[model samples]
Target: MLQLEIVTPEKKIYSGPVHDVYLPGSEGEMGVLEMHAALVTSLVPGELRYTVDGKTEALAVGTGFAEVTQERVLVLTDMAAGEAEIDEAATEAAIERAQQQLDQLDHDHDLEEVAMLEAALAKSFAQLKLKGKYKGLQ
Candidate 1:
């Protein structure tokens, strides 16, 4: 078993043993299992999945970094939420708001603001995708 711990700025969402773990690496998706190599990598907004007790669970996570060791995996992210924690309507509204903000930016705009808005839009989209996937399971 591999000890997996996911923490956000607000709290620690999960800390337990898992059979396998998958993360959205900055370049692409990657999987980690017990005895895997030790490393650290940046994570993008996407779905993070893990298998525990023969059941696979998932969470939508925002920008962060992950530290993987032979026996433990630590995920430090800006945001992490399960399907039940994501509100579809609210996520949709957030996406719209972000889009509006991005659209308002003209030829000369603050790069940081644009990046922040894009990040927010991407995170909101990830949440919506996770919610949709869980709904399909119902």
Candidate 2:
């Protein structure tokens, strides 16, 4: 078993032993299993999946970093939510709000604010997609 922990600024979302983990790495999707190489990688706003007790579970994760070791995988993300935790309507509203903010940006707009808004929009879309994909399975 490999210890898997997913943490956000507000709380520790998950902490347990998992059979395997699939991360949305910046380079691409990467899978981790027991005794995998030790490494650190940046994560993208996308779906993160893990298997435990022969059952697979998923979470929508925002941009962050992950540290992988032989026995553990620790993820520190801006946002992380299980499929059931995501509210489709709320996510849609957030996407709309972020788009509006992006649209309001001018030529002289701050790059930092633009980047943040874009990240928010991306995260919202990822959450919505995961929620929609798993809605029927739930």
Candidate 3:
């Protein structure tokens, strides 16, 4: 098994051994099994899955970073949410809200506002992708 730990500024979301893990990379989805080589890479907004004690659990994660060591996998991200924590309606609403802001913004938009909107869009996309893949599990 591979030790998996996920952390955010708010709290430590998870810490334990998992048989396998899949992360959404900026390039594409990546799967790591036991004894995988060490590496650190950026992740994009998408679904993250890991099998723990025979049961597979999925999470919606936003763009961030992941470090894979010989024995442990550490993920640091701005957002991480399980199925229960993810509200589809709320996420969809957030996408709409962000889009509205983008539309109303002036010709010369604030960089901070633009970044916030982009982040919101990524988060919402991750949720939708996770929900789509694991509907029965969710």
Candidate with best TM-score = 1
Give the CA lDDT, 0 to 100, for residue 92 in model 2.
94
Please give, for residues 38-59, the per-residue lDDT of candidate 1 as tens digits.
9999999999999999999999
Q: Whole-model lDDT, candidate 1?
A: 0.95
RMSD of each: 0.9, 1.1, 1.7
Question: Which scores greater on lDDT, model 2 or model 3?
Answer: 2
Instruction: Quote the positional error of residue 28 for candidate 3 in Å.
Output: 0.8
Worst 10 residues of 3 by lDDT: 129-138
Query: Which runs of model 3 end up more than 4 angstroms from their true locations?
Result: 106-109, 136-138
Candidate ranking (TM-score, best to worst): 1, 2, 3
lDDT of prediction 3: 0.89
TM-score of 3: 0.90
Q: What stretches of model 2 exceed 4 Å from their correct place?
A: none
TM, every model: 0.97, 0.96, 0.90
lDDT of 3 by residue, 1-138 (tens): 899999988999999999999999888999998888999999988888999888989899987899998889899998899887778898899999999998887737587888888888988988987776767752
